[model samples]
Target: MCLIHFQYGEHPIFQLIVVANRDEIYDRPAEPAHFWEDEPEILAGRDLLEMGTWLGISKNGRFAALTNFRDPSLPKRPRSRGEIVRNFLKESVHPSEFIDELAKMKDCYGGFNVIVGDQNRLMHYNNIFDEKNEIFPGVHSVSNHTLNTPWPKVVKGKKRMVEYLKNNPGQVDIDELFEIVMDREIAPDEELPDTGVGLEMERNLSPAFIQLPHYGTRCSTVLLIDRVGNVTFVERTFNSGHFKFEKSFRFKIQK
Candidate 1:
């Protein structure tokens, strides 16, 4: 997922609320969100090219999502960052412990930012900043940059999420959450963050929703974990920048 805006452990009824968009090359083959035949306990979309995932959750409450660090000039790496999330979801290791493992081979992959844990606890790790952090409750975000870097979409999405939660108390509207991330408004030139992708390319990716000739948002996902440990995951996928099919799954934490 490229842009992730969330309220983690700050809602009255929900422990974690996430709205994100997965941006990628439209031609990359991928399966919509589903339980894997091999790993039925795990639920997530599959990246067919790498056989990994950008975001996923396990029956035992393990959760993970990843965003590539937006640096096009870096040397090509031998590893696919999708495995970062897929590996975490498949294993039972604590996020803190996984950091120790990732630190050893971080250079093998391109720069990436990942958050992993359950509803009650979480950690953020990025090879670019090369830092690990325990996530505190409240509104936060991450795009192609570090966590909470205040990119236009990140800041805007966070604000909208906070507003949505505040306005609708005691309820989590899945559709509204999805709508928040559907914002197609592009960031003004001055408000854009320079990620070395140049002004034109930056502008193309500035919106919370993005559509380019080849590279654009492939799916928008909203994951909600409530105080009672109920989990909801929804994925809306697009075909060549148009709506394709959507998948929604709801289940209680197996913990």
Candidate 2:
């Protein structure tokens, strides 16, 4: 997913709330969110190349999101996309510690942006350019940039998300949050990073259409991690040809 809008410890009741969009090519192979029969602890879209995901949670209430870094300048590094998510689910490391370990590797494992957090803190790391930043306790949006610094889509999306959150500050469910991320109405004159998947044509064909059979936002996910170590996850997949939601899954995290 290219963008993640999250609120951690915002409400007195809920612990964590996140809305994300998984952007990728139209032809990549992937299955909707499902538990792997062999690896039951993991829950997300299976087998996506250039796919971003909200990885499985740990027993200790840790949450992580992995997205590709959009830097074409960096040399390719050796790292498996699935392995990154697997490691997050398998380990109990803090966000800072996890980022520290990622920074030591200079092998350029493709461009990646990882956000990991819990009830108390949030950390974001960009491996493409070797940059890292932390978000204080507040409503924030992370795109392909480092925080909010006027990167066209990032700036415009952040403003739109904040405005939505301000107006609808009530306890939001997963679907409501997904609507905010799937919003593609605001078109800026600035250029966007080319995904080589022909998003322009897709957008032109269907502005509100999510082309599932070929390309577009393949998945919309919302993850809620409560204070008591309970994690709730929901994912929806769009139809490839019709751009309508085809399937969905809702489940909780168990050891």
Candidate 3:
């Protein structure tokens, strides 16, 4: 996932609420979100080329999402970062242990920021900075850089999400959440982060929702988990820059 806005243990009814967009090249082959046939417990969209995923959740209440850290100077790692989320969901390990292991192998993969959790707790880990953080009850976000780095879209989107949740306190409105993820407004030039990507490319990727000729947001997903351990996952997919299909599923976490 390229952009993510999530609240944990903040709202009265919801334990965790997430709104995220996954960006990639339009031609990259990927299957829409679904429960894997081999592992019915896992629900996520698969990256066909790598046989991994950017985000996924398991029936046991395990959740994971990954984002790449933008840095042009670093050499690409041999391993695919998507496996970070895939391995987390496939295993039954605690988030803390999983993060510890990831930290040890940080140099094996490209720069990345990852979030892993279950019904009980959430953990954030980044390989680029070699740090591990515990997620407390509150609002947080992570994009191409560090988590909550105050990028324009991250700030605006977090505020919008807070307002949305406040207005609709106990309920999760899929449409409104989608609206927040679909925002395409570009940030002012001064507010854009210089990630080594040129000014033109930086502007292109500034919005909460991104659209480029060949590379853009491929899917948007909203994950909601209530106090009772029920989960609602929804994913809207796009084709060659056009809306293609949407898939949603609901399941109660086995306690």
Predicted structure with the largest lDDT when compared to the true one: 3
Tens digit per residue, CA lDDT, model 2, 32-118? 776666556656666656443445555455567776655446566666655666666557787788888878872546677777766
TM, every model: 0.98, 0.77, 0.98
Please identify model 3 stretches exceeding 4 Å from their true place: none
Q: Each candidate: how many clashes?
A: 0, 9, 0
Task: Please give the lDDT score for candidate 3.
Answer: 0.91
Better of 1 and 2 by lDDT: 1
Q: List the residue pairs that clash in candidate 2.
A: 1-52, 26-214, 26-215, 69-111, 69-112, 77-108, 77-109, 212-240, 213-240
Expressed as tens digits, the lDDT of each residue in 52-149 for candidate 3 is 89999999899999998988999988899988999999898889999998899999999999999985699999898998999998889999998899
Which stretches of model 2 miss by more than 4 angstroms?
A: 48-54, 190-214, 241-255
Ranking under TM-score, best-scoring first?
3, 1, 2
Candidate 3 C-alpha error for residue 10, in Å: 0.9
